[model samples]
Target: MRVQKIWGADIYRDGGSYGFCFDSDDGQWYEFFLKTRAFEPVSPESHQPPIIYRNGCNSGEVVLRLSWEEAQAFVAPLRYENRRFMELIDIVMTSGGTARRH
Candidate 1:
């Protein structure tokens, strides 16, 4: 895996997907997810039910020998969740307020 710098994290990519190793406030290198270079989320609510695929902070880590399959698996869910959440939010915003159906 080749290492690169992304969002201040040590990123690695082997052809199909990208991986990263970054430090947290605890100062440990956890498994960082290979997020899409496409969209960047602005609100915390933006990263919901489907994936928003943020730029800096990802879902998980990018360990050694991180393959594309593994990366996609990690990334796919996030986008799905984020997008779903945003859709819900859009519905609420259009409704003009937040209220439980119950």
Candidate 2:
């Protein structure tokens, strides 16, 4: 998925880095991290979104904040449906959310 679609969403900042939270359909939250330097240039410019590149490095990698089981349990449903949960998790994980700047 393109990062621009959710550019206006909440961005978490920690020290010199900034991260955007993405809620996956599978009930997981993924944080896409970018350096302060990288974000500073594009954050102030409205004409175009930031340019980010993931070159098999940890900096631009997406990290999971919650697992499907953890997230499902957190909501605490009145009744448990293992079968339905499994089916939905499989589908959701297959087409997970992504963030990329073009």
Candidate 3:
């Protein structure tokens, strides 16, 4: 089945790369990866362009590249939730409360 939604808390970002988990229509979970690069202009009159690369995990840890638009669709929903969660964590920590593992 196709992926239906993504979980906000499962996303990880490191520099120009990102990874996230999603739930499919069949109720299965999977992870995806995205990496971006800024390419310099080829000539003095040109402007820099951004390149985004997307990938999905296959069986046995293999990752296959996907289109940028497809990857963005999967990740878009989680953006706000992810930021909100982090803000909540920050509030808790700053208020002298320690975050504990469940």
Candidate 4:
């Protein structure tokens, strides 16, 4: 599905990035990830959403932070929600939430 249409209902584009929170379809209490797409836009003044971050990282973890940033850092924004993205995102979200690993 087109990224915009799939989650556009809950997504917000700001500056050069697009972001969304893990809100349920009911739309409530969604803990948002600030500036989740860590890309520097190709078109600086085009107003188009930026691409995803380079291979995704936590931008160098601190003594109190993991390199993955607990999903706090915006990874590259996905152009399409393909299966690979699903799997990777599952890993990201699970690890971020400190949930039981599969």
Candidate 5:
């Protein structure tokens, strides 16, 4: 597949689905499920849920490709609120109550 880089990991995308390959880590790649907001690792002979159809069909082939921006657009909306909330929590934790309203 067409390799894309995001957050130091090689990313593969087919529509909203994503697979992240980190060479520094183990021999498995992480597949992100949009519906559940969860991830599963895909190994050589042990792929859970059998990966995705497009992914399984196009394995190692660059047939289906989406730009990084398109991928981000599909993913950003999924976690935008959570990311903002996490930012708020970070401020609360690091700002020593300075960022809190009285």
Candidate 6:
């Protein structure tokens, strides 16, 4: 499946994590979360890092995990949009809430 667009992205300073939302080719929208530490590689050959997503079962005890490669494929088509989201995040963070984007 391909990503149509990234609709939202945010860095949670208090939680020390990042989250993003995107639409897929199947006409479904997904929101996923990742920890800051996930960006660090466990080994040199580790390419498929994991990401976390809240489970929809309402149990508040489970999470769905996906690999980095899988996440990459999900956002490949809309890579530029993801990049823009990150850029906006950086600007907002560095500017101390003086800048905004929508």
Tens-digit lDDT track for model 4 on 29-99? 22222233324444222222222321122333212222444342433454335443343344344442211
Off by over 4 Å in 1: 1-13, 35-102
On the 0 to 100 scale, the lDDT of residue 25 in model 1 is 47
lDDT by candidate, in order shown: 0.31, 0.32, 0.38, 0.31, 0.28, 0.46
lDDT of 5 by residue, 41-70 (tens): 533211112121233333543322433334
**For model 2, the run of ten residues with the poorest summed lDDT:** 45-54
TM-score winner? 6
| Candidate 4 overall lDDT versus native | 0.31
1-102: candidate 2 lDDT, tens digit per residue: 222222222222432333333444544444433333333354432111122223211345433334434433422332223443333233223322222232
Error of 1 at 79 (Å): 20
Residue 19 of candidate 6: its Cα lDDT? 60
lDDT of 6 at 48: 23
**What TM-score goes with each of the models?**
0.22, 0.24, 0.38, 0.24, 0.22, 0.45
Error of 3 at 6 (Å): 2.7
On lDDT, the candidate that comes out on top is 6
- lDDT for 17 in candidate 2 is 36
Tell me the lDDT of model 5 at 57.
Answer: 35
lDDT-sorted candidate list, best first: 6, 3, 2, 4, 1, 5
Clashes of each: 17, 0, 0, 4, 0, 0
Please tell me which model should have the higher TM-score, number 1 or number 2: 2
